[model samples]
Target: MAYTAKDASTTLFRYLNITEQSIKVIENTNKRGFIYNTANGEKCVIFIYPISHKSDNSKNFFDTRDSGAYERGVSWNYALQNKLKYFCFAVHDQVEKYNDYVFSLECQEKIIEKVSGTLNGSRIGAGTQVVIPNDYIPNKQFERIFTKNGFFIAVIHRDNIIDYIDKYDNRPYLIDDSLIELDELETNDEDSSQSVALDDEYLSKLSRNRILFGAPGTGKSYKLNEDREKCFADGNYERVTFHPNYSYAQFVGTYKPKPKFRTDGTEYVSYEFVPGPFLRTWINAQNSIKSRTNKNYLLIVEEINRANVAAVFGDVFQLLDRKTDGTSEYEIATSEDMREYLIKECGFEADEIATIKIPSNMYIWATMNSADQGVLPMDSAFKRRWNFEYIGINQGSSKIKDSEITLKPYGTVKWNMLRIKINDGLTEAGVNEDKLIGPFFLSDKELKSLSIDEIFKSKLIMYLFEDVLKHRKGKIFKSDFNTFSKIIDAYNEGEEIFDFDVVSFLPDESNEESALGSVAEEPGKYSTENE
Candidate 1:
């Protein structure tokens, strides 16, 4: 609640605390603002302009006829750690938009020059300084941005010092830090600068070694995919899944046989070092850095715990501790094979790839379900290097409510309804939440299938019969559906699997068809991993 806090009115008066008497927009003024003391040893003034999206317009952004008075509200988007932070204004659902008119030539140009790479935003036509997708804005509450918790506007910041023009009006600006209540904590400008530097969003953006872990089907993978598409803008990324046999050599790099023909036409086998996902991504990040390209690179590891993670990461484990700039805190020396490969093939300096270090723009994210059958436990030392995000069972229920699950014999039930019933039963029976089904336990196509297909049974019913409901089967299914084969057969053969009259909870046909009409399922695109 920076706006509500003492000495933070440039934003509050400009957008939130609006009244004709307090923050009136001058008829002829393009923008106006006052100065306030920040902890950075100087004054900070925010210049903002009022704008809102017009729903009726399709092609053009702002309506041009100028006679009408516009009523603007704001979406008070804040990080979980820092409450009541920044609010963005944009016509689109994802990226916030601001025209160049609101910013100074320096703020407009320098914002793109100095901050575009570090900030997850793009500028257009040099017209807007920043265009950030709200979700990618770390520490932000994702759902509230779209709901218009309030209307939005644009803001800019610059330093202010006492430079008077004349005896009465020598300074460029008209406001003072004392014009607003000076928060005791913000009395010094340097303290405010340090506070801004340690903001949650800033820290999270720099160091992104995060793991989305939860029970099967809880949308851990779904959430990660979201981060893939939105947070990192779906470019300069690599995806790898880890399993029991997945090893460090495969993850980082190893030499493999390459068949080649000599000039004499004799075929020969050459052992060539092939860089795996990790090294390949690092190489790309290094190239991007060398070229000074403002691109973010990602390494998505699905089912991280499915493999013996320690063995898979091997010596690279130490490289997980990221510095504030997101580079590996420490570098691990590369194997000889890797060093030779780096110099000859990847254009790396002998000194550079001799040791492997993760780059700042490069990120490693993973999905884990400890309840999975073959999952290997992570040591505390390894676990401490990553931030864990637990996907709640209902984390994304709203997206799939229209999905219908039809038991050939029991009839069609809303996917969410049946999922809730199953989860509730498991909970009441004392089954751990981690052993329960998640919102994305079944894909849309799987949910719509009348019979339990191989994909469906293996992904879901087997999970329920073998793990989640192994000891708690009586809560949802018949006591004698004891074995995986038995329950799956019952499910596929039109026999009653659930003890309850689930058909009684079937969603209305009209609602189902109207809502999910012809919505084609793009397998693995939206919901791939069952983590």
Candidate 2:
């Protein structure tokens, strides 16, 4: 049977199990090609040209002296100039010497050198080959070229053509198109949309590092917990609390004295470098990236503003400036002890010990309460690097159910409503917005389970006396019960019981003059006496 360009195009499409509608055949006097679009919208072409041979023997793979060889070299240069990812295959007829043909390493090297010249300094090697392997194709490896009889198949794509290669064994004989399984190809195409959506969501959540900030009890830390669980598994994440005493030695890693037991059972103190949460998370991220797991490692910092971030981060602060690709902009040098520890205990290569960088896959998430008055202020330069998300107070009924407290005469009051009332009272008293009550303050499940008196004594009274009244004394209440002790006595002994009316302390919307004043003031001061 005589072979033709049309025959080759038909065979290529049949091998790939692609429909005719998805591929167009291009037949020319010099070459035959197939044009198609990948699932990712990349245009691709597979071109095949006949190689001149001096004899019918397969041993004579190509006639290098012939004009066909020069034309083939020109074609390769054209492909390179056009920036197309091309794979070349040399075809031959069956020869008596070899039952099955395999391109020798020597021939592969020659082909690579010839293609490299055409590429103009571009690298080309054995990896560029598209072949049907008799044995198993290793996992993560791609096969691109195939050969049968006197036909050589060449594939070119705008993107990485290797990604399209199927990891399955090729039969010695031409298999029917119906036998080919296109399930992997279809699955990959379907996953493309999902992958894009995931990327968008990931970018929105955090481009580099992010800090979720809000008033206390606004659920900033809770948001982090939900996100951590959604994005990563337990082993892939680590959480740490930052406070006034937090230091670089405790965050990154440090040399500390550890007790070691001798052979005789007596203990001896030895100085050794210990890895901290940040370092451990970084190491795990590096390993995951090296293994090509496509997973992210998370580091959660609670109460980030509580610590002197500059002092705690030290040289590691430089790592916060990330490149568009998400890698650290600078590699900070590690301490000698850290270097030694990384190489000896962490399995880092010797050459990698000089400097350390936070990997792109290692994400840092932090939570900060805006209500924290004693925290070390973060500078503009430091604050500008991180993405900030504000968690607002949630007034949902479900959330309110977590802390519904019942009182005499008042019946049951939802924490959400109480929060709104208290915030309104604070606003009327001219207190700062940051000092306003957040719904989370009274939403604890344990607090919700408490009796009315217990709830008032344990949470509400403490919040009023310690947080609110401590800051805005007599300005928030009437002169008779201006102090917390007076208010507590009124509620406990039921003396001057009218002062214990919590609702009376909230602003009244019906009276315009008293709208900006708390109901705790003398009745006739802001509003007219009852008619």
RMSD of each: 18.4, 21.1
lDDT accuracy of residue 482 in candidate 1: 70
Residues 1-531 of candidate 2 have per-residue lDDT tens digits of 443434443544544457667765433214444455545555444444222223443223322223233333333344333433333333222222221122211111122223222211223221222222322121221212333211222222212222432211111112233433322212122212323333436444454588876566666677677666556643456688999999999999887775656657799987867667788778767755654444577889999999999999889888988887788989998888888876654446668768878888889988887566678898877887787765554322235443556655455555555566666656677766655665566556645565756676666766666876675654545557766777677667644322224555433435423432332222112211110
The whole-model lDDT of each prediction reads 0.52, 0.52
Model 1, span 129-185: residue lDDT tens: 232222222221111111111111112211111111011111111223333221211
- For every model shown, the clashing-pair count is 19, 3
Worst 10 residues of 1 by lDDT: 69-78
Model 1 / residue 40 / CA error / Å = 51
Those runs of model 2 whose alpha carbons end farther than 4 Å from true positions after fitting are 1-204, 394-398, 401-403, 494-531
